[model samples]
Target: MAKKAVCIMSGGMDSTLAAYMLRAQGYEIVAVHFNYDQRTQQKELESFRAITARLGTGQTYEIDLDFFAAIGASALTDRSIDVPTGGIEAGVPVTYVPFRNGIFLSIAAAIAEKEGASVIGIGVVEEDSSGYPDCREAYIEAMQRAVNLGTRDETQLTIAMPLVHLKKEQIVAEALAYDVPLELTWSCYSDEAAACGVCDSCRLRLKGFELAGIPDPIPYRVKNGVS
Candidate 1:
Protein backbone atom coordinates (compact mmCIF):
# COMPACT_ATOMS: atom_id res chain seq x y z
CA MET A 1 0.00 0.00 0.00
CA ALA A 2 1.19 3.56 -0.72
CA LYS A 3 2.31 5.46 2.38
CA LYS A 4 -0.08 8.15 3.51
CA ALA A 5 1.16 11.72 4.01
CA VAL A 6 -0.70 14.54 5.69
CA CYS A 7 0.53 17.94 4.51
CA ILE A 8 -0.06 21.07 6.55
CA MET A 9 -0.89 23.60 3.87
CA SER A 10 -0.89 27.23 4.99
CA GLY A 11 -1.38 28.22 1.35
CA GLY A 12 2.11 29.74 1.42
CA MET A 13 4.80 29.01 -1.14
CA ASP A 14 6.81 26.61 0.97
CA SER A 15 3.83 24.59 2.22
CA THR A 16 2.21 24.43 -1.21
CA LEU A 17 5.47 23.31 -2.75
CA ALA A 18 5.87 20.70 -0.01
CA ALA A 19 2.50 19.26 -0.97
CA TYR A 20 3.51 18.94 -4.63
CA MET A 21 6.89 17.47 -3.72
CA LEU A 22 5.30 14.78 -1.55
CA ARG A 23 2.69 14.03 -4.18
CA ALA A 24 5.43 13.66 -6.75
CA GLN A 25 7.23 11.30 -4.38
CA GLY A 26 4.15 8.98 -4.55
CA TYR A 27 2.77 9.65 -1.03
CA GLU A 28 -1.00 9.81 -0.88
CA ILE A 29 -1.65 13.41 0.31
CA VAL A 30 -4.33 14.77 2.57
CA ALA A 31 -3.97 18.55 3.08
CA VAL A 32 -5.06 20.01 6.39
CA HIS A 33 -5.49 23.80 6.43
CA PHE A 34 -6.09 25.51 9.76
CA ASN A 35 -7.94 28.78 9.81
CA TYR A 36 -6.14 30.42 12.69
CA ASP A 37 -7.88 33.75 12.16
CA GLN A 38 -4.68 35.27 10.91
CA ARG A 39 -4.72 38.42 8.83
CA THR A 40 -4.13 36.50 5.61
CA GLN A 41 -6.52 33.71 6.50
CA GLN A 42 -9.08 34.42 3.80
CA LYS A 43 -6.53 34.82 1.06
CA GLU A 44 -4.59 31.73 2.05
CA LEU A 45 -7.70 29.59 2.47
CA GLU A 46 -9.08 30.55 -0.95
CA SER A 47 -5.77 29.90 -2.63
CA PHE A 48 -5.38 26.58 -0.82
CA ARG A 49 -8.77 25.44 -2.04
CA ALA A 50 -7.90 26.25 -5.63
CA ILE A 51 -4.42 24.78 -5.52
CA THR A 52 -5.60 21.51 -3.94
CA ALA A 53 -8.31 21.25 -6.57
CA ARG A 54 -5.75 21.75 -9.33
CA LEU A 55 -3.43 19.13 -7.86
CA GLY A 56 -6.35 16.63 -7.92
CA THR A 57 -4.42 14.08 -5.87
CA GLY A 58 -5.52 14.99 -2.35
CA GLN A 59 -8.39 15.97 -0.13
CA THR A 60 -8.48 19.35 1.67
CA TYR A 61 -9.56 19.59 5.28
CA GLU A 62 -10.42 22.91 6.90
CA ILE A 63 -10.37 23.51 10.65
CA ASP A 64 -11.52 26.77 12.16
CA LEU A 65 -10.33 28.27 15.46
CA ASP A 66 -11.59 31.68 16.54
CA PHE A 67 -9.76 31.38 19.84
CA PHE A 68 -6.45 32.08 18.14
CA ALA A 69 -7.51 35.66 17.52
CA ALA A 70 -8.22 36.37 21.15
CA ILE A 71 -4.75 35.28 22.17
CA GLY A 72 -3.25 37.11 19.24
CA ALA A 73 -0.06 38.83 20.31
CA SER A 74 1.47 38.60 16.86
CA ALA A 75 1.05 41.00 14.00
CA LEU A 76 -0.12 38.18 11.75
CA THR A 77 -3.28 37.76 13.78
CA ASP A 78 -3.55 41.14 15.46
CA ARG A 79 -3.56 44.44 13.57
CA SER A 80 -2.51 46.30 16.70
CA ILE A 81 1.09 45.13 16.54
CA ASP A 82 3.19 46.17 13.56
CA VAL A 83 5.08 43.56 11.57
CA PRO A 84 8.70 44.20 12.41
CA THR A 85 10.64 45.75 9.58
CA GLY A 86 13.82 44.26 8.09
CA GLY A 87 15.43 41.01 9.25
CA ILE A 88 14.82 40.16 12.87
CA GLU A 89 18.45 39.55 13.83
CA ALA A 90 17.95 40.49 17.46
CA GLY A 91 15.77 37.58 18.43
CA VAL A 92 12.41 36.00 17.76
CA PRO A 93 10.37 38.85 16.36
CA VAL A 94 6.96 39.91 17.54
CA THR A 95 5.59 38.28 14.43
CA TYR A 96 6.23 34.97 16.08
CA VAL A 97 2.82 33.88 17.20
CA PRO A 98 2.86 32.34 20.65
CA PHE A 99 2.89 28.54 20.51
CA ARG A 100 1.55 28.89 16.99
CA ASN A 101 3.36 25.97 15.40
CA GLY A 102 2.98 23.89 18.53
CA ILE A 103 -0.77 24.26 18.35
CA PHE A 104 -0.85 23.59 14.64
CA LEU A 105 1.41 20.57 14.87
CA SER A 106 -0.50 19.04 17.75
CA ILE A 107 -3.74 19.39 15.82
CA ALA A 108 -2.13 18.01 12.69
CA ALA A 109 -0.77 15.04 14.60
CA ALA A 110 -4.17 14.26 15.99
CA ILE A 111 -5.62 14.43 12.50
CA ALA A 112 -2.87 12.15 11.25
CA GLU A 113 -3.66 9.66 14.02
CA LYS A 114 -7.33 9.59 13.07
CA GLU A 115 -6.50 9.32 9.37
CA GLY A 116 -3.73 6.78 9.92
CA ALA A 117 -1.17 8.75 7.95
CA SER A 118 2.41 7.61 8.33
CA VAL A 119 3.99 11.01 7.74
CA ILE A 120 3.11 14.61 8.56
CA GLY A 121 4.63 17.26 6.30
CA ILE A 122 5.39 20.75 7.58
CA GLY A 123 7.00 23.60 5.61
CA VAL A 124 8.99 25.32 8.34
CA VAL A 125 12.34 26.63 7.09
CA GLU A 126 15.53 28.13 8.51
CA GLU A 127 16.24 31.25 6.46
CA ASP A 128 12.80 32.80 6.57
CA SER A 129 12.13 31.88 10.18
CA SER A 130 14.73 34.35 11.44
CA GLY A 131 14.70 33.64 15.17
CA TYR A 132 11.33 32.03 15.70
CA PRO A 133 12.09 29.37 18.31
CA ASP A 134 9.29 27.13 17.18
CA CYS A 135 10.52 27.01 13.57
CA ARG A 136 13.90 25.56 14.45
CA GLU A 137 15.06 21.98 13.88
CA ALA A 138 15.31 21.31 17.60
CA TYR A 139 11.67 22.24 18.09
CA ILE A 140 10.59 20.04 15.23
CA GLU A 141 12.51 17.12 16.59
CA ALA A 142 11.17 17.57 20.09
CA MET A 143 7.64 17.80 18.74
CA GLN A 144 8.18 14.64 16.71
CA ARG A 145 9.35 12.78 19.78
CA ALA A 146 6.38 13.94 21.76
CA VAL A 147 3.94 12.93 19.04
CA ASN A 148 5.54 9.54 18.54
CA LEU A 149 5.49 8.84 22.26
CA GLY A 150 1.94 10.02 22.64
CA THR A 151 0.69 7.90 19.76
CA ARG A 152 3.27 5.12 19.71
CA ASP A 153 1.26 1.92 19.75
CA GLU A 154 -1.69 3.47 17.98
CA THR A 155 -0.48 5.51 14.98
CA GLN A 156 2.93 6.40 13.62
CA LEU A 157 3.52 10.11 13.06
CA THR A 158 6.76 11.10 11.40
CA ILE A 159 7.16 14.85 11.25
CA ALA A 160 8.77 15.62 7.93
CA MET A 161 10.30 19.04 7.35
CA PRO A 162 11.95 18.87 3.96
CA LEU A 163 12.41 22.63 3.86
CA VAL A 164 13.68 22.88 7.41
CA HIS A 165 17.31 23.24 6.43
CA LEU A 166 16.83 24.86 3.02
CA LYS A 167 16.92 28.51 2.16
CA LYS A 168 14.07 30.41 0.58
CA GLU A 169 15.67 30.38 -2.84
CA GLN A 170 16.27 26.64 -2.60
CA ILE A 171 12.62 26.11 -1.73
CA VAL A 172 11.57 28.22 -4.70
CA ALA A 173 13.85 26.25 -7.00
CA GLU A 174 12.39 23.00 -5.77
CA ALA A 175 8.87 24.33 -6.23
CA LEU A 176 9.63 25.36 -9.81
CA ALA A 177 11.13 21.96 -10.50
CA TYR A 178 7.96 20.36 -9.18
CA ASP A 179 5.84 22.74 -11.31
CA VAL A 180 4.00 23.99 -8.23
CA PRO A 181 1.24 26.50 -8.88
CA LEU A 182 2.97 29.51 -7.33
CA GLU A 183 0.23 31.78 -8.56
CA LEU A 184 -2.27 30.04 -6.32
CA THR A 185 -0.31 30.55 -3.09
CA TRP A 186 -0.58 33.65 -0.91
CA SER A 187 2.45 34.96 0.99
CA CYS A 188 1.66 38.53 1.76
CA TYR A 189 0.34 39.32 5.24
CA SER A 190 -1.91 42.00 3.88
CA ASP A 191 -5.64 41.89 3.27
CA GLU A 192 -5.84 43.27 -0.27
CA ALA A 193 -6.90 41.16 -3.23
CA ALA A 194 -3.47 41.62 -4.75
CA ALA A 195 -0.37 41.05 -2.66
CA CYS A 196 1.17 43.95 -0.83
CA GLY A 197 4.79 43.71 -1.88
CA VAL A 198 6.22 45.70 1.03
CA CYS A 199 5.57 43.44 4.00
CA ASP A 200 8.41 41.36 5.41
CA SER A 201 6.82 38.13 4.14
CA CYS A 202 6.18 39.53 0.67
CA ARG A 203 9.65 41.04 0.49
CA LEU A 204 11.21 37.73 1.40
CA ARG A 205 9.05 35.97 -1.18
CA LEU A 206 10.05 38.47 -3.85
CA LYS A 207 13.70 37.99 -3.03
CA GLY A 208 13.36 34.22 -3.10
CA PHE A 209 11.90 34.25 -6.61
CA GLU A 210 14.61 36.62 -7.75
CA LEU A 211 17.36 34.44 -6.34
CA ALA A 212 15.74 31.33 -7.79
CA GLY A 213 15.58 32.96 -11.26
CA ILE A 214 11.84 32.32 -11.36
CA PRO A 215 9.25 34.89 -12.29
CA ASP A 216 6.60 35.04 -9.58
CA PRO A 217 3.22 34.59 -11.22
CA ILE A 218 1.23 36.03 -8.32
CA PRO A 219 -0.68 39.23 -9.07
CA TYR A 220 0.52 42.28 -7.16
CA ARG A 221 -0.99 45.72 -6.85
CA VAL A 222 2.43 47.36 -6.85
CA LYS A 223 3.44 45.82 -10.15
CA ASN A 224 0.03 46.44 -11.73
CA GLY A 225 -1.56 49.30 -9.88
CA VAL A 226 -4.66 51.24 -10.95
CA SER A 227 -3.67 53.96 -13.37
Candidate 2:
Protein backbone atom coordinates (compact mmCIF):
# COMPACT_ATOMS: atom_id res chain seq x y z
CA MET A 1 0.00 0.00 0.00
CA ALA A 2 1.20 3.52 -0.77
CA LYS A 3 2.09 5.65 2.22
CA LYS A 4 -0.72 7.96 3.21
CA ALA A 5 -0.13 11.67 3.99
CA VAL A 6 -2.63 13.98 5.57
CA CYS A 7 -1.83 17.38 4.03
CA ILE A 8 -2.88 20.57 5.80
CA MET A 9 -3.39 22.96 2.92
CA SER A 10 -4.42 26.62 3.07
CA GLY A 11 -5.48 26.80 -0.60
CA GLY A 12 -2.37 28.94 -1.18
CA MET A 13 0.61 28.43 -3.46
CA ASP A 14 2.88 27.16 -0.70
CA SER A 15 0.49 24.55 0.63
CA THR A 16 -0.61 23.46 -2.86
CA LEU A 17 3.00 23.02 -3.92
CA ALA A 18 3.81 21.06 -0.76
CA ALA A 19 0.91 18.68 -1.37
CA TYR A 20 1.98 18.29 -4.99
CA MET A 21 5.45 17.36 -3.80
CA LEU A 22 3.95 14.72 -1.49
CA ARG A 23 1.85 13.38 -4.36
CA ALA A 24 4.98 13.17 -6.51
CA GLN A 25 6.55 11.09 -3.74
CA GLY A 26 3.62 8.60 -4.11
CA TYR A 27 1.69 9.55 -0.94
CA GLU A 28 -2.05 9.12 -1.14
CA ILE A 29 -3.08 12.63 -0.13
CA VAL A 30 -5.78 13.25 2.43
CA ALA A 31 -6.33 16.97 1.92
CA VAL A 32 -7.28 19.23 4.83
CA HIS A 33 -8.34 22.89 4.87
CA PHE A 34 -9.59 25.18 7.60
CA ASN A 35 -12.21 27.91 7.29
CA TYR A 36 -11.43 30.31 10.13
CA ASP A 37 -13.82 33.13 9.24
CA GLN A 38 -11.06 35.23 7.78
CA ARG A 39 -11.72 38.11 5.41
CA THR A 40 -11.18 35.85 2.41
CA GLN A 41 -12.78 32.68 3.77
CA GLN A 42 -15.08 31.94 0.86
CA LYS A 43 -12.43 32.61 -1.74
CA GLU A 44 -9.96 30.37 0.07
CA LEU A 45 -12.48 27.57 0.44
CA GLU A 46 -13.28 27.87 -3.23
CA SER A 47 -9.62 27.59 -4.09
CA PHE A 48 -9.16 24.59 -1.77
CA ARG A 49 -11.94 22.68 -3.48
CA ALA A 50 -10.51 23.36 -6.90
CA ILE A 51 -7.00 22.34 -5.92
CA THR A 52 -8.18 19.11 -4.26
CA ALA A 53 -10.14 18.08 -7.34
CA ARG A 54 -7.03 18.54 -9.44
CA LEU A 55 -4.95 16.48 -7.01
CA GLY A 56 -7.45 13.58 -7.09
CA THR A 57 -7.58 14.00 -3.32
CA GLY A 58 -8.44 10.84 -1.39
CA GLN A 59 -10.40 12.26 1.58
CA THR A 60 -10.88 15.92 2.43
CA TYR A 61 -11.34 17.60 5.80
CA GLU A 62 -12.98 20.98 5.38
CA ILE A 63 -12.71 21.97 9.02
CA ASP A 64 -14.51 25.10 10.18
CA LEU A 65 -12.71 26.98 12.95
CA ASP A 66 -15.25 29.65 13.86
CA PHE A 67 -13.76 30.47 17.26
CA PHE A 68 -10.92 32.29 15.58
CA ALA A 69 -13.28 35.13 14.80
CA ALA A 70 -14.23 35.46 18.45
CA ILE A 71 -10.60 35.33 19.56
CA GLY A 72 -9.66 37.79 16.90
CA ALA A 73 -6.43 39.76 17.13
CA SER A 74 -4.99 39.40 13.67
CA ALA A 75 -6.21 41.54 10.81
CA LEU A 76 -7.44 38.52 8.92
CA THR A 77 -10.05 37.71 11.57
CA ASP A 78 -10.54 41.12 13.20
CA ARG A 79 -12.33 43.78 11.21
CA SER A 80 -10.78 46.51 13.35
CA ILE A 81 -7.13 45.49 12.86
CA ASP A 82 -6.33 46.73 9.41
CA VAL A 83 -4.02 44.60 7.28
CA PRO A 84 -0.77 46.42 6.67
CA THR A 85 -0.55 47.95 3.21
CA GLY A 86 2.57 50.00 3.73
CA GLY A 87 5.10 47.21 3.26
CA ILE A 88 6.55 44.20 5.04
CA GLU A 89 7.50 45.48 8.46
CA ALA A 90 10.67 44.68 10.39
CA GLY A 91 8.83 42.75 13.13
CA VAL A 92 5.99 40.24 13.21
CA PRO A 93 3.31 41.63 10.93
CA VAL A 94 -0.27 42.30 11.96
CA THR A 95 -1.52 39.39 9.83
CA TYR A 96 0.13 36.77 12.00
CA VAL A 97 -2.69 34.80 13.57
CA PRO A 98 -1.85 33.85 17.17
CA PHE A 99 -0.45 30.30 17.16
CA ARG A 100 -2.50 29.64 14.06
CA ASN A 101 -0.16 27.05 12.58
CA GLY A 102 0.14 25.30 15.92
CA ILE A 103 -3.62 24.98 16.22
CA PHE A 104 -3.93 23.84 12.62
CA LEU A 105 -1.23 21.25 13.10
CA SER A 106 -2.93 19.89 16.21
CA ILE A 107 -6.19 19.47 14.35
CA ALA A 108 -4.37 17.96 11.40
CA ALA A 109 -2.76 15.51 13.81
CA ALA A 110 -6.18 14.33 15.00
CA ILE A 111 -7.25 13.84 11.39
CA ALA A 112 -4.05 11.97 10.55
CA GLU A 113 -4.43 9.71 13.57
CA LYS A 114 -8.05 8.91 12.66
CA GLU A 115 -7.18 8.30 9.00
CA GLY A 116 -4.24 5.99 9.73
CA ALA A 117 -1.90 8.25 7.86
CA SER A 118 1.82 8.18 8.50
CA VAL A 119 2.70 11.71 7.48
CA ILE A 120 1.24 15.18 8.02
CA GLY A 121 2.28 17.72 5.40
CA ILE A 122 2.31 21.49 5.98
CA GLY A 123 3.69 24.36 3.89
CA VAL A 124 5.45 26.72 6.28
CA VAL A 125 8.13 28.89 4.77
CA GLU A 126 10.46 30.39 7.34
CA GLU A 127 13.37 31.99 5.52
CA ASP A 128 11.12 34.07 3.26
CA SER A 129 8.06 34.39 5.49
CA SER A 130 6.64 37.58 7.04
CA GLY A 131 8.09 36.62 10.45
CA TYR A 132 5.08 34.68 11.70
CA PRO A 133 6.45 32.91 14.78
CA ASP A 134 4.37 29.78 14.25
CA CYS A 135 5.79 29.35 10.77
CA ARG A 136 9.24 28.67 12.18
CA GLU A 137 10.74 25.24 11.57
CA ALA A 138 11.75 24.80 15.22
CA TYR A 139 8.20 25.45 16.39
CA ILE A 140 6.84 22.91 13.92
CA GLU A 141 9.39 20.34 15.01
CA ALA A 142 8.40 20.88 18.64
CA MET A 143 4.75 20.39 17.67
CA GLN A 144 5.66 17.11 15.98
CA ARG A 145 7.32 15.83 19.14
CA ALA A 146 4.38 16.90 21.25
CA VAL A 147 1.97 15.22 18.86
CA ASN A 148 3.85 11.92 18.98
CA LEU A 149 3.86 11.97 22.75
CA GLY A 150 0.11 12.52 22.88
CA THR A 151 -0.90 9.94 20.27
CA ARG A 152 -1.05 6.18 20.62
CA ASP A 153 2.34 4.53 20.51
CA GLU A 154 1.43 2.56 17.40
CA THR A 155 0.08 5.62 15.61
CA GLN A 156 3.39 7.28 14.86
CA LEU A 157 3.31 10.31 12.56
CA THR A 158 5.88 12.35 10.71
CA ILE A 159 5.18 16.08 10.42
CA ALA A 160 6.48 17.00 6.99
CA MET A 161 7.31 20.63 6.22
CA PRO A 162 8.86 20.39 2.78
CA LEU A 163 9.00 24.13 2.18
CA VAL A 164 10.05 25.24 5.65
CA HIS A 165 13.42 26.65 4.66
CA LEU A 166 12.74 27.61 1.06
CA LYS A 167 12.41 31.12 -0.30
CA LYS A 168 9.17 32.18 -2.01
CA GLU A 169 10.99 32.38 -5.34
CA GLN A 170 12.18 28.79 -4.99
CA ILE A 171 8.64 27.73 -4.19
CA VAL A 172 7.28 29.53 -7.22
CA ALA A 173 9.85 27.98 -9.51
CA GLU A 174 9.34 24.53 -8.03
CA ALA A 175 5.59 24.78 -8.42
CA LEU A 176 6.05 25.72 -12.04
CA ALA A 177 8.32 22.74 -12.58
CA TYR A 178 5.67 20.46 -11.10
CA ASP A 179 2.98 22.13 -13.22
CA VAL A 180 0.94 22.90 -10.10
CA PRO A 181 -2.22 24.96 -10.63
CA LEU A 182 -1.10 28.37 -9.42
CA GLU A 183 -4.32 30.05 -10.56
CA LEU A 184 -6.34 28.00 -8.09
CA THR A 185 -4.41 29.29 -5.07
CA TRP A 186 -5.36 32.35 -2.99
CA SER A 187 -2.93 34.38 -0.81
CA CYS A 188 -4.65 37.66 -0.16
CA TYR A 189 -5.20 38.57 3.50
CA SER A 190 -7.93 41.10 2.74
CA ASP A 191 -9.91 41.08 -0.49
CA GLU A 192 -12.01 38.20 -1.77
CA ALA A 193 -12.72 39.57 -5.26
CA ALA A 194 -9.28 40.66 -6.45
CA ALA A 195 -6.15 40.23 -4.35
CA CYS A 196 -4.99 43.46 -2.73
CA GLY A 197 -1.51 43.42 -4.22
CA VAL A 198 -0.06 45.77 -1.59
CA CYS A 199 -0.68 43.42 1.34
CA ASP A 200 2.41 41.69 2.72
CA SER A 201 1.21 38.26 1.58
CA CYS A 202 0.45 39.51 -1.90
CA ARG A 203 3.74 41.40 -2.06
CA LEU A 204 5.73 38.31 -1.15
CA ARG A 205 3.86 36.26 -3.73
CA LEU A 206 4.46 38.87 -6.43
CA LYS A 207 8.11 39.15 -5.45
CA GLY A 208 8.45 35.37 -5.71
CA PHE A 209 6.99 35.26 -9.21
CA GLU A 210 9.20 38.15 -10.27
CA LEU A 211 12.33 36.52 -8.89
CA ALA A 212 11.34 33.24 -10.54
CA GLY A 213 10.90 35.08 -13.85
CA ILE A 214 7.31 33.84 -14.17
CA PRO A 215 4.08 35.77 -14.06
CA ASP A 216 1.71 34.54 -11.36
CA PRO A 217 -1.47 33.14 -12.86
CA ILE A 218 -3.78 34.50 -10.16
CA PRO A 219 -5.42 37.87 -10.67
CA TYR A 220 -4.12 40.80 -8.65
CA ARG A 221 -5.70 44.23 -8.39
CA VAL A 222 -2.26 45.67 -9.00
CA LYS A 223 0.62 43.43 -10.05
CA ASN A 224 3.18 45.88 -8.62
CA GLY A 225 3.68 45.87 -4.85
CA VAL A 226 6.23 46.97 -2.22
CA SER A 227 9.58 45.37 -2.93
Question: How many residue pairs clash in each candidate at the backbone level?
Answer: 0, 0
What's the residue-level lDDT of 31 in candidate 2? 97
lDDT of 1 by residue, 1-227 (tens): 66778899988998888888888888989899999888888888998898888877556689998887899888888889977645435687777789888988998898888777888899998768767888898999999999988885868688888888888888888988898888888988765488877666777787788888878898776532221
lDDT, model 1, position 27 = 91
lDDT of 2 by residue, 121-197 (tens): 99999987898899889899999999999999998899999999899999998998898999999999999888989
Report every candidate's CA lDDT.
0.83, 0.92
Residue pairs whose backbone atoms clash in candidate 1: none
What is the Cα-based lDDT of residue 56 in candidate 1?
74
In Å, residue 203's CA in model 1 sits off its true spot by 1.2
Q: List TM-score per model, in order.
A: 0.92, 0.97
In lDDT terms, how accurate is model 1?
0.83
Error of 1 at 36 (Å): 1.3
Off by over 4 Å in 2: 225-227
**Model 1, residue 221: what's the lDDT?**
64
